[model samples]
Target: MSPRWKWKGAEAKALAEPISKTVSILQSSLTRTEASGLLSNHNVLLSVEAEQAELLDRSCFGRPVVACAEKEDKRWIQLTFEEAFFLFYNLNCIKISLHGRRLENEVELWRFVRSIKPNFATSYKAYSHLRLKNWIVRPGLQYGVDFVVYRHHPSLVHSEFAVLVKSVDGNDRLRVWSDSHCSVRLTGSVAKTLLVLYINGEEVNREDMNLPLCLEDYTVEEVTVRRWSPELNREHDLSL
Candidate 1:
């Protein structure tokens, strides 16, 4: 079983245990019960007090703005919405609160997060998919993609793939030829593969949002694209 907490801060430990009544009651269409059980035997929600949130100003949750020792931290939570959900939904480490009131269960939390991010389900499906496969995922804003994945920790190895989310409803985005070429070219320049995740291409959103978290309702397919080079395509000294 996965460890309950990555860092056992006093407050985080206090926050991590205790299965909410709502969690066990939820009837999500769990497509991978075995995988889910491997991480958390019970379901999880999310939360962090402002004081505890301040602690996240470091490397794990967020980055140091100036990299100097004496600067006031003028940054937001470093973890993206997706990352937060991963900590809650996958790791079951924290319960999320808005306006200081905790969102008691996954159903309530999912609705809240979905309201803020229209593409929550699709984005999260890809994020959790990579995570379940044991890849380290981080936001790819710098690379102009949805995510960047590492085989190991960022300090141990550089990111190996840049991910782009493509939803059937198109709430996130799909690249055209020029955009696609640019994405491929950019990732290639940095020695990374460009992977596009097509979410729910043939399947439509389940009408009842509650039925979706199981991953059975969402379908994600990955496609990797690279720009072919004639000069590099030849073997040895053979001409193309």
Candidate 2:
């Protein structure tokens, strides 16, 4: 009985709403029913609009939800709380049901997620910036980072970068050399660049305060790391 959207008939109310159809929250992952509903309906929208949308890339407009493999012929629209919040805040998609009642607005969603992770505000700011850049961002827990960013939809290409968000305030501690090295190498192994994003701003005391508005006042720096080795750096001879 976690929060879910109630859609009546065939088409969805909004472009992003289709992704919320039949969604249920368990543990922190958002799951969507795979049978005929928003998923199928969304595909039809893509088909019908494919020609009209030629001026813009139709692939990017479908839905932002990610489907994780559950079993044979089955997949779930699993997303992290941060990812869900991003969709809610940026796209205004997905109606959440909490305790059988719908939450009023983004503020309620912010408070709910903040209760789960106190560091949500900082991460949300960083996430919104990256999303605004048109990068496909996803939770990067397995990679020991905050997000994995792809140049395009994941279905179209592999993620190109792993992002780690760090506070820029003087109180924040420096990352361990070994940990940084490991993260860089791991991301390289998977064909992704490691990007460390530093969020510069004073910490906020109220969850009700708009985080996105404050993002404009904050500065972020992107740092990419790479391993340098003599073997890897060796130059190859060219045939005349």
Candidate 3:
């Protein structure tokens, strides 16, 4: 006969204890009015301070307080200011790889990511340009850039560049589709192209803007977009 699996209630309780403690601490730090303001800012619709406190108390027990209260005809207490900030802080700890692929839920991650790094698309483009320059770069949410690259030489200026990264395939197609599926046309003859290059900590400019004419042109490889996975969603603590 196969052995029976046992539920680890104790372990579950132990894990929940810390979260409860944290919530209690946060509640104690604020007054009723402040707590109400916090919830209001996070779009939580609470009728009274007492209701908000009750929700916080329930959260510690790993209960779906918002959902449960709604079911009971009680308006859900929105996430308190402290709670919202802490939640976002915890979310940024999740690592995002290049090509916008997260080992976790991209949508969930994007919500937190967008909250913290609103200009994600632009930063992504700047990172791509830097990557082509052969500098090792990764997403820099803390610095508010799409990426962070290590400087190999001291002579190179340590500066951040604003980048605009767009989905070449999707945006183009979407634009045309929205415009009654009509094809877009390119205007004007090419006069001159400018090539901007970064080599050994120096920016080199050239008249002809072609990859072959650039001082150091490296082929950029595309990173495949990741799909949402149910297993990954189950692993993360997405209380919502």
Candidate 4:
């Protein structure tokens, strides 16, 4: 049997808007010089298709979907906005190879979002945090911290925390590596923030441990546990 694939709905939607806007901007901004640059970067010859020629002549915004065609010799080719961005970013040109021939823009933001895995991870983390009632969690660019969790009620007087997620393949081996990396990243002034190590289910330990709490690993899971501070660390009493 094949492993189950998880679906994230909210993230799939957030990615669409930005991709649509980028397509519109690129279409309007493509000048003779820019076009030449794009062609040179991708190492492709460029000619606009008749259908899209008038669309290019006029300015359009937030269309979400558009198609462009390329001309080479006697042939005319069509492309999507997703293909256009890929060409622009990777080859520095607008021409793309789709459905056998060179094609031009039909950039759907969702398509671009689906192609890149990291963006999905960030989105998943954001959604997960939001669902946990952490309203202030947003995407962070620097210091390798994926999500910042803020205190929901300011009156409760708890420190804000940062969550670092590591998707590891194995239990024992990945735990050591995950710990070292998390420690280094969460050290110094930010050390006060709780360091939670979320792992996939595979390994089990006999005893309940304390401090810089190492929670049990689970597969396809979400659990929020408070970090063990030196002052708050206590032994698990079996005397019930």
- The candidate maximizing lDDT is 1
**Per-residue lDDT of 53 in model 2:** 26
Residue-by-residue lDDT tens digits, candidate 4, 1-240: 111113344334433433334335545444333442122222233344443343332212112213443233222222222233333543343433433444343232223333543233223433333423423343333545555443322122222555556545323312576665554545334543533445453343423111112221333444433434565445646363
Q: Taking the tens digit of each residue's C-alpha lDDT, what string does model 2 give over 29-79?
A: 211211111212112111112221221122233232234333343333434
Each model's lDDT comes to: 0.59, 0.54, 0.32, 0.36
Question: RMSD in angstroms, all models?
Answer: 11.6, 13.1, 24.1, 16.9
Q: Which run of 10 residues does model 1 get worst, by summed lDDT?
A: 32-41
TM-score of 1: 0.64
Error of 2 at 200 (Å): 1.1
What are the clashing pairs of model 3?
A: 44-78
Model 2: CA > 4 A from native:
1-76, 169-174, 206-213, 229-240
Estimate, for each residue in 122-210, the C-alpha lDDT of model 1 and write its tens digit: 88899888876756677899999989986544544567889998876674444468787788889889888999888774455455654
TM-score for candidate 2? 0.60
Give the range where candidate 2 is weakest over 10 consecutive residues by summed lDDT.
Answer: 33-42
Task: State model 1's lDDT.
Answer: 0.59
**In candidate 2, how many Å is residue 182 off?**
1.3
TM-scores, all models, native as reference: 0.64, 0.60, 0.20, 0.31
| Ranking of all predicted structures according to lDDT, beginning with the best and ending with the worst | 1, 2, 4, 3
* Candidate 3 deviant stretches above 4 angstroms: 1-103, 136-240
Candidate 1 Cα misplacement greater than 4 A, ranges: 1-78, 171-174, 201-206, 210-214, 235-240
Top candidate (TM-score): 1
How well does candidate 4 score on lDDT at residue 2?
Answer: 19
Clashes of 2: 1
